[model samples]
Target: MGEPSAPGTPRGDRLHHPQLTTLVDTARFHAAHSPQVTAVVCEDRALTYARLHRESNRVAHAIRATGAAPGARVAYLGKESEHYYEILFGCAKSETVLVPINWRLTAPEVSHILQDSGSDLLFLEDEFGPVLDRLPTAPPKTVVRLAEGTGPAAWTAGHPDTDPALSPTPDTPVAQLYTSGTTGLPKGVVLAHRSFFAVRDALAGAGLDWIDWRAGDIALVGIPGFHVGGLWWATQNFNAGVTVASMRAFAPREAIDLIRDKGVTTACVVPAMLRMMLGEPGVEPDDFTTLRKIVYGGSPISEALLEESLALFGSEFAQIYGLTETGNTAVCLPPADHIPGHPRMKAAGHPYPGIGSKVIDGEGKELPTGAVGEICLATPAHMVEYWALPGKTAETLVDGWIHTGDAGYVDDDGYVFIQDRIKDAILVAGENVYPAEIENALERHPGVAEAVIVGAPDERWGEKVHAFVVPVAGREPSPRDLHRFLVDRLAAFKLPAAYEFIAHVPRNPSGKILRRALRDRFWNDADRKVN
Candidate 1:
């Protein structure tokens, strides 16, 4: 129960984000300034800013009727919908933390997060009922299904549409998103209202067109709302009082059609989606005429993919590098350096305005330029802490910096080159083998559509380089030929000792390669997931 950020006072850096300070501010500000603007598009329904704000007020009162007050957690498990914003902004207005669930997760995974967050009320779509039934135990809270003219909407209609004016400061807990839990159990990353607005101020201060959010600009929300990427993307547009075209689920074809049909000016997508969109039928040079920018991240983009993407979309590309812990993009590779052959194109761009980053050695000391070390970032948008995990938070957020588990180096020109995940990096007879290097090289081959490299258990070499490749349609090259192609490009040891051709490489919802899943097939009997 903290007081609202002393009326108009700016927090974090000296830069002031005049748009909104808290999560609920989007509805409040936009409803007053641009009431008739179409704020969200999900399917056939579009919610105007005024109606969105008014509906959120009623929803806030409805949630309050459930006996949940400020600081209580309310979870939502469902797909992207126009009503999703009502639930989000309403909870914000009610001064409750919104815990958005990943619909792709299993029952156990979802259950763990609900239990961890201590949610007092669960709002889910009718389709998700089966998932709840699969769970061993129900969410220990009141459950309400969300749908039109029924459930949450029906119940909320009885309440009046008036702002509660609950006072929540910028430091107040707003949303708590659980991590993907690749290496371990998922932990809720607690976000304050500042986690988002801080980024807003930084982007405005930098004065970059790539993120120069403006009215009439349509943004395609392809990523799920559960990830910080999607939430931040939507927030940016909301902050600018612009329109967001939502794709309930990300299908490359549907996404392309939405961009063209909606005149989407910019979008945030991963490299995999870009590849799929380029390969989709009916793709033409003019198909993406309205798209001016494409911000991609989650995983590094291969040089081959980057070149193809530039030729296909014809949009200025910006690369973002950050994690859920840092809210979103702390460092941005601006569109200017997206040149196909530029050396800096391969590097993660410099830190955003008001954000500081440095390479730190194992001892937590700053590493000199060109020396590989952990990339530590101190951004205004850093998450408050790992929910209820102080020990883990202490290990990650040391001092004012978050030690990014990524192994990379800051070059003399202040460009950061991410090598690979330190935990995923393999040691072959004391020689480090970064899977990305091999995967990038494999992807460059004209016959290979995509590639993923991982370390396999080996007695003699400690761990051996293993590659899974998806060949181009109607093309098949022997492993020996692929080896010869790599022999000249990579060290002899870096070349894959084993190769398996597959239809596709499995990836997580965020577009990150599930290297653990790939490695698991070979080491089913092993005790640990990592080699």
Candidate 2:
């Protein structure tokens, strides 16, 4: 944490507020300081700071009325909305953990999360009632229906709108966000109240604006709240006492219009969402005039797409890199390093002021600079553990550092350059080929909009690289053309052996490419079993 300013000073008074350590304190502080400020707006509903605080208080009372004790799990299955934020703070005020499940999951997936979390109560939107009916077993101990205008239920409305007056420390568990499960079963990453405010505290009076919050800035929460990125972004803005406009679900055309109509000054999204917004018809630079900065992450982006987006959006772009375990971002490629063709454009930026990062070999020894190894990060915002998986938690969280399974190297200047997931490397004739390297090269082509690389089981060699390409609108490049373009860049062994052109690549809600889905088609046909 950064050093505190002198007492009695404005900065000191603002940064050292006694009521800013937990989510409960945050809601109270903002409501007391700016009661009439619009805290959150979703669709046609808006909540002022005063209303959010009072409504969440009623929700806390309602939660206790259901016999849910402190520290119990409260699950919410719904899209992004003002109601979601209300439930989140309600869970906070009641000293319960909030589990926001991915609404896009199927019935089995939803059931698995509900069962695994041992939730005491559930709050679900009416839109997913069918999923609830298909559950193999009974629902949680208590289930409440959430509608657009009903707001939790009429019973909750009858509860008192006064603070529960419960006190939770900064280390109290407040949120449990699940992993995307691209590699295997999703593990719940439990984050405490401190996770949401670590970066903000680190930036206090540091004279850095790498990611800053200002008054009158309306942030757009395009990503869903189930993802840590979206949840963290919204909370950070709220902690700064700024208004946020959240979408029920992301629609590119609707998002563009919201930016224009709401005068949104800051936004967060993944690279895939940016592509979709740019692809929308009749979108012009003027449509995004209100945006001052745009934060992007969740997957590696090609230089071609970044340059195009920078030109169209005309906003400062900052790239973030991290996993759900690290509370969203441990490294940020700031707007200053966003030059189109600069070498540092490919580098993941330096760690935040208080965060620590390093690369270590399989033997747990620190590696020299520029040597690829598993990237590990030590941050105050690191998760407490994987829910009910002590062994997995120990394997991942080592000595206060989280072993991020990603392979990367640090330069002399401390810029981290990610290669790919260590397990995703493809082996051909004893040579290693990283899918991201090939995908970056393919996306550099003018005709390619996006590309994904996956490894397929082979009889001759252990594995071969296969490419899935999404062409730009009105342009189609054949395999021969791609091969000719890449012949001089990548070695013959690293080149893809086959190509499959598709309309769009499959991605999770967080915008990570589903490499396993593409690779499974080949392995299933070849009778080669893989995890």
What is the C-alpha lDDT profile of model 1 across 1-531, one tens digit per residue?
001111111233222337578868778888998899998887777889998899889989998998997989999998887778788889899999999987766676678888889997998888888778877666657888776423367768789999988868889988999863333366889988888888667655555453566547888887688878888888878877888887777888888888878789889876667877888988876778989888877655666788888887888888887878898888778777777777887676777667777887888888877888888888878999999999889988988788778788877656677764555655453344567667777888989999888888764444688999999998877799799888755646567988999998898899988888887776678533333
Best by TM-score: 2
Task: Give residue 192's error in model 1 in angstroms.
Answer: 0.8
Task: Give the local distance difference test score of model 1.
Answer: 0.77
TM-score of 2: 0.79
lDDT of 2 by residue, 1-531 (tens): 111121111233232233487889989999999999999987777889999999899999999888888888999998888888889999999999999987876665678789988997999899988889988777998888887555674758789999999999989999998763333356788999989888777656444566778888899997789888899999988888889998988899999999999899999987767888889999999999989989877664567788889889999888877767888888888788888889887776777767888899999999988898888988888999999989889988999898887788888777778765655766553333567767877888999999988887654344688999999998889999999988755547668999999999999999987888887787665322321
TM, every model: 0.78, 0.79
- Candidate 1 off by > 4 Å: 1-19, 148-151, 425-531
RMSD of candidates 1 onward, in order: 12.0, 11.6
Error of 2 at 142 (Å): 1.1
